[model samples]
Target: MWQNLDYVSERRADTVMVLSGDHIYKMDYRPLLAYHQEKEADVTIAVMNVPVEETHRFGILTVNRQGRVVEFTEKPKERDKGTLANMGIYAFRAGVLHECLPRYAQQYSDLDFGHHVIPTMIAEGYRLYAYRFDGYWVDVGTIQAYWETSMALLDPDSPLQLYDRAWVVHTRSYERPPAKLGPQARVARSMICNGCIVRGRVERSVLGPGVYVSPGAVVRESVVMNDTWVGPGAVLDRVIVDKQVVVGAGVQLGCGNDVGVPNTTYGDHLRTGITVVGKAAHIPPNIRIGRNVVVHPHVDEEDFVSYGDEVPSGETI
Candidate 1:
């Protein structure tokens, strides 16, 4: 039910936050919000120390010897081994937002909070507190990240659970029946959302609502969003398709692929192999989307688009 609403921060809240939409983890904001209130800080950010190898793409923070904020960099070119990274989940005081964002928009019109606002606050001597987060966290910003994060849900040792009676991971709903498998359907260790018809073999995948996998289709290690149709004998591996995309019969996506590269046309990831397909985009049937591909919205037929394809709006591909 909460899924229908956009993940953007609400207008009426005293604090506005920017959360990652593709993450599979669940967290209660009360503790972090309460801490921010207690500190009476201008901004409180939730941070976690990612591995040194993965810090290149994240907004890294630096604290002085006493843990007071000293510097913040948005995706620094170099990494310090033990530095903390901002999770993009920011809690900002409404007054700070009103005072800063308007002036912010005048300067860096295209900048987001992570890229501009947070760093600006640190420069202005705002009381920026860092709240260390130790619970389960996943960043599903790319195809590989999506695949890995979704697969993590199936692991017994995974800290994230969808079936938790107390805290449910709610998403947009179609209010349809549970996923139905045909007599010959073969499914294993996958997440099948509501309103899906599984008549094929799906292994280690995340299937969103209204996903229709035709008979003989095999999907493995992939993420398929809502209203997607996989025609008969189609196969998907390590690929991510946006909403309403259709795979023509016998289509092969992400097959014979490496973990961090997408074959479909899309932008390059800060870290490679995270293929991103923007919302409401389309992928033609029989077309092979390669690894690490970044596909923009509104792609039409026509373009050499094997990988990293961009479809401009108001124009056919």
Candidate 2:
């Protein structure tokens, strides 16, 4: 993203604050900026204390008592007592950013801020400070992370609060009506969004807008996105179905006995190795899909029918 910094630099700003959009976080940047200005730092990085076991997934930092960042490593295999991980939020002096970003872009093939830019700035003796953030933050980088974050939103004690009117996370509003559940339908510990018509059992699942779950279908511990159609008697457990997909009657996805093997045929990384059906895909009637199987987007009925009755575990279609 440093390549895109030319616009900010051209504006002749005093400070440039950069943040990662992929993370699930709720923070007020005003305090961070104030701290940066108070320290008169050339670069200020937001750091948070994460679990030691999760150190390999983030850029770890070791800071002096003065809050001056002394050492930084990206995705280290081993970590010390310094559990402060980089939150991918930085405040840089405009001049320093403009000067260093261009030099780094020209010199290095990998221009990632955590991996190269910040480390290069530290090596050049920049006055870098660490801004300690104690709030809740999670990087939704993988499927399992996404699922866990989604489920966490339903918890009453979740750190990431959404019901607070003062700090609202706004999104594009839809004109759809309230979700409708059938007389015999049963739903618990789930979030059903607007315009969903549920005539089946939905437990510990999230249903996006305009989803239709037919009678006798069961969805548990899964996320079904917008406008999807689940036919009668279908079963989905520990699965993620993207927008506008069709699941036929008696079809099953996610065997609930996943071994968590890594596979990348679905174009996205999965942590729990759960089954994923891409957007707009069509699953034929009575077909069974095993755990960790991926049905690619826009795949035809022949793909599943060709596999006989069930798609094997860990296979990507």
Q: Which candidate number would show the highest TM-score if scored against the true structure?
A: 2
Q: For candidate 2, what is the TM-score?
A: 0.94
The whole-model lDDT of each prediction reads 0.71, 0.88
Q: How many steric clashes between backbone atoms does each model show?
A: 25, 0
- The sequence of per-residue lDDT tens digits that candidate 2 reaches over residues 1-317 is 57677688578779988888899999999999999999999999999998899888889988899999888999889868488899999999998977898899898888888989988888999999999999898898778888899888778787898878899999996899999999979999989999999999999999999999999999988999999999999999889999999999999878646546545465347536578999999999888887778888998788776799888777889
- TM-score, per-candidate, Cα-based: 0.72, 0.94
How much is the lDDT of residue 65 in candidate 2? 95
Off by over 4 Å in 2: 256-273
lDDT of 1 by residue, 1-317 (tens): 02212332354667766577756557898898998889887888888888887778788888766445677887777776356888878787876777777677778858577778778888889888888888888776654566677788767666886678899766566588888999979999888888999999999888889999999999887788888888888877766778887676876665433544323333344235444555566565666554455556655544436433322211122
For candidate 2, give the lDDT: 0.88
